[model samples]
Target: MKRLLAMGCGLLVLGWANGMAAAPSPDTASVDKAIVHLAPTKGNKVQGTVRFETVKGGVKVTADLTGLTPGKHGFHVHEKGDCSAPDGSSAGGHFNPTGQAHGGPDATARHEGDLGNLVADASGAAHYERVDQQLTLQGPNSILGRSVVVHAKADDFKTQPSGASGDRVALGKIEPEK
Candidate 1:
């Protein structure tokens, strides 16, 4: 009888743990489809896609950008997730959660929206993957309604923290595909 009781307790605990692992947290959601594409600019044309999923603490943003000039360009999630306007002007400033000054994505005290730079190869393509726990896709400060921007130059990673990435070349809105 004692042995059976112990076995049952162990099984119950194991089952509970498994159930928790299989369940999705209320704050998390899967980004079924995030379509990022290139918009025609007066000079260059850049395009890409960012796929993400809500993890326990934050989100994982995976991206693939191509057709940019060969160099390091600033990449960021802007304040307004709108890419409707030409030249991708619809997307506003960087995502600034802490109300900090505009800076680099990896800066210690920069804007919450700054995401640093993307390095393109000689072939003019940039590929990257990153995880962010500070952004929400549906809540008050969700990144879902934001846009991603690719700059014309490398983000210096210093100097106001925005890396001085030049003109916004490529722009895309973070939206679920219909």
Candidate 2:
């Protein structure tokens, strides 16, 4: 048995040397979990990670963030995954594939990316966990290539287009976890 396993491994290595590679892993569309590594846009010090796991009705979002003021900060997945430009403007607007107006996560008429707020404590650390029924990980409305933006202020949840969330402080593109 061990000899056979060794031969298989050797064959794989030999294949690699001959310009052949193993089959590709499942792409983002078929993945059940994803992670985003947040980085400050420019001069900000905010940093964090956000994770998404598919659940029964929707997806579970888990976020751990730091370097925020001791208050509420807007948090939402943006339409585009581009975080290249300073101030995070390259990410585009809030993800509203359904054409709904800005609202809270629990609102029925909210945009698909309206995830509400992240409250940081006095130490500037915030840990948020929520199961979002509107956010998805598969099919036409998949958020696989989107970006999550943390704003400088709280989401009013009643504004048009995007909640009155202030300037984007940190951003990270969602990608399938390796």
Candidate 3:
């Protein structure tokens, strides 16, 4: 009888251990769509809103920005969600969880945050829309909690690390869309 009781207790402990080791599945519904409302950095008037929605191929990025210099500007998703710094440095480097070298969105080897550039019109307003294949709202490569940064100059895709993008002009934290 003692042996039987010990066996039963062992089974119960094993089951409890298994339950404790399991992790809950990610909430896919909460990440179906996300948005970032951008605010201008110090001495800059750049402002924008970037929307990310799960589409057929990947996440569709739609950005509408104003007060830009009428040319190309670097746009990327940084690793951190904080945009508290006056120069937008609060949001750290590009979101490159895979440790890949910097390259354009089309490059076979590129950082997850290498989003290329946003072109501004003569009126200092820019509207950009593209479907990014590398970005995701869920899973390990998720961009859900990251931040979007708009640079003052263009992203010269060939440059190393960060494409030599100039000072951050605008920043916003990516969040789930209500």
Q: Report the C-alpha lDDT of model 3 over 1-178, residue by residue, as the tens digit.
A: 9999999999999997754332122454457899999999999999989999999999999999999999999999998888899999999999888799999989878999999999999999999899998888876568877899999999999888899989999999988899
Question: For candidate 2, what is the lDDT?
Answer: 0.88
Clash pairs, candidate 2, are none
RMSD of each: 12.3, 11.6, 6.8
Task: Return whichever of 1 and 3 wins on TM-score.
Answer: 3
- Off-target runs (Cα >4 Å) in candidate 3 are 1-29
lDDT of 3 at 47: 91
Q: How many times do residue backbones clash in model 1?
A: 12
Give the deviation of candidate 3 from the true structure as CA RMSD: 6.8
lDDT of 2 by residue, 1-178 (tens): 9999999999998977643211122244568898999999898989999999999878999999999988999999988888999989999999887788889999998888999999999999999999999887776577878899999999999878788889999999998877
Candidate order by decreasing TM-score: 3, 2, 1
The residue-level lDDT of candidate 3 at 99 comes to 92
**Model 2 misplacement above 4 A:** 1-29
Candidate order (lDDT): 3, 2, 1
